[model samples]
Structures are given as structure tokens and as C-alpha cells.
Target: MKTLMYVFIVALGTLACQQEKKIGYVDNGTVINQYQEKRDVEDKFQAREEAFTKRADSISKAFQLEVQQTQIDARKASQKKAQELMQGLQQKQQMLQQQMQFEQQQLSQAFQTEIDSLIIKVKTFVRNYGKDNGYTYILGTSDAAASVLYGTDENNLTQIILDALNAAYQKQ
Candidate 1:
């Protein structure tokens, strides 16, 4: 028993000296989607989109009514007058189309900017979490790119880091 204890202690010491690095992994999609801030951002954009679509629909209906009225009046007017009315309607349609396109583009850009910012913020949070927790490496995996093929649940930091991140966000 004494000889066995001596060999075990020596083996333990040798293994301690080896200093194996700790590694972990996280599901990027899960972390990003489950984040409160990201959800809020998405909700905000959805509301804005709903409002914009509503307003656009109203404008289109009004435009359609005007077109119908103009068409009715054109039948009783001179040929030259009808031509003038049609030209004006065409120009108005073009302007409305352009304005709607510009507004849509602006909305899309703003949403993308917010999303991009959130992605960077998440990355930084994960990096700091890894460093602070003494993780030698924290691999990220997503549907688009699977950086971690397989990792044990013990080494999975998805919920742990996500909870910390939300707690920090709440503090802010």
C-alpha cells in the first residue's frame, strides 16, 4: 500500500506539471438568438417595418383612387388634356416609386447596421468571458460554419456564457 501510494503521488505530480489546457465551445446561433438585446433589436425593426408597410399601403390605395378618378375624367376631356393628365400621373407614380425605394433602402441599412454591431458586441463579450474564465480556447460553431465538430457537454459554455452576458447587459 505504501509503494502504491508513492507511485500515485508521483504520477499526479507529473500530470500536474504537464498543465493541460482547458478548452470550451459555444453555439454561436444559440447565443446570438437567445440574447435579450438581439431580440429587442429584432422586435424594434419588426415594428418599424409594420408601420412602414402600413403607411405604404395607405399611400398606394390613395394613389389608386386618384388614378381611377383621373381615368374617369379623361374620357370627357379633350385629347390633349387627357394626354397631359396621363403624363402627370406617370410622373407622380415614378416619384412615389423612387421615394418608397429610398425609404426601404434606409430601413434595410439601419437594421443591418444594428445587427452588425450586435455581432461585434457578442464576439467581444465571448472573448472577454473566455479570458476572464481562464479558458485556453473557446470555439464557436454555427450552421454556416462548424468550427467545432464535436465537444462534450462538460466543455460546452453556451448557457454559462449567455447567462453571464445577459446579467452584464442587465447591469448596463
Candidate 2:
């Protein structure tokens, strides 16, 4: 029993003495946020939002003008007709607002899906790059600083990975 224990201890020590290799990590979040393509997507979304707001404003102005005209009429039938028009206008506005919200939601989801796909592509690229270059590992540093620190010189592969992604992107 003592001989077996000694053998086990010797084996464990030998394993522990072996060198463990690690690759590098990059702050992916930083790269994505600073990326020109990402900025372009955000700019496009903002432009669309502004256009939708303008359309809503125009509709609102038309509704208000009709309401003012309706209020000036003295006949019961005219007043009733005006009320119906006002109600219809209100319903239209509400529907437009809802449509806008739904579109915004869909756009947000689509952006998220696109960003997710890009992240996956970057990760896969890193993996292949690492394997090809004989790296042991490569990790992503997201927009958050969970795995990375500020002013870190260690494992900062941001530029390397970014270049690889852009190259792949351009090829596609």
C-alpha cells in the first residue's frame, strides 16, 4: 500500500511539473464598438428612426387641424361626424405608433442577430488562426472588461484579430 501511494504521488508531481500553454485573448467588445461597420449600422438605424418620427409628427398635425375644424361646427350631425373622424384619427395614430414600436423591436432583434453572427465568425476565425499558427487558446474580451483589464499589454490580440476579421469580411 505504501509503495502504491508513493507511485501515485510521483506521477502527480510529474504531471504538475509539465508546462501548460495558453494562447491570447482580445477585447472583442472594444473592437466591435469601435468598428466602422458597426457604427454604420447604428447610423442607419438612427436615420430610419428620425424619418419615422417625422411621419408621425405630420400625421399628428393633420389630426389636430381636423379636430380644430370639427370643434367649430355647431350642428349635432356635423359634431357627431367630427367626433367619428377624430376617433378614427386617434385609432390611426395609435396603429401607426404600434407599428413603429413593432418595427423598432424587429430592427433591434435583427441587429442583435447580425452582431451575434459576426461575433461567432470572429471566434471561429480566431480558432482557425490559432490552430494554424500553433496557438493553444484564444479568448474573447467582450464590450465589458470581465476578462480583460485596462492598459493591459498581456494577451492583447485586438489588432491581430481585427485584421483577420476584416480580411475575411472583405473576402466575403
lDDT of 1 by residue, 103-145 (tens): 9999999999999999999999999988998999999998899
Off by over 4 Å in 2: 1-20, 73-79, 142-145, 149-154
Off by over 4 Å in 1: 1-17
Tell me the RMSD of model 1 versus the true structure: 5.3
Best by lDDT: 1
> How displaced is residue 11 in candidate 1, in Å?
14
lDDT of each: 0.94, 0.73
In candidate 2, what are the lDDT values of residues 1-172, reduced to their tens digit? Answer: 9999999999999999886776677777766766555676678878877886788688778867866765555244576686786677678768877887887788788778877876676667778888987778776766555664444566677787777766666675
RMSD values, in order shown: 5.3, 4.6
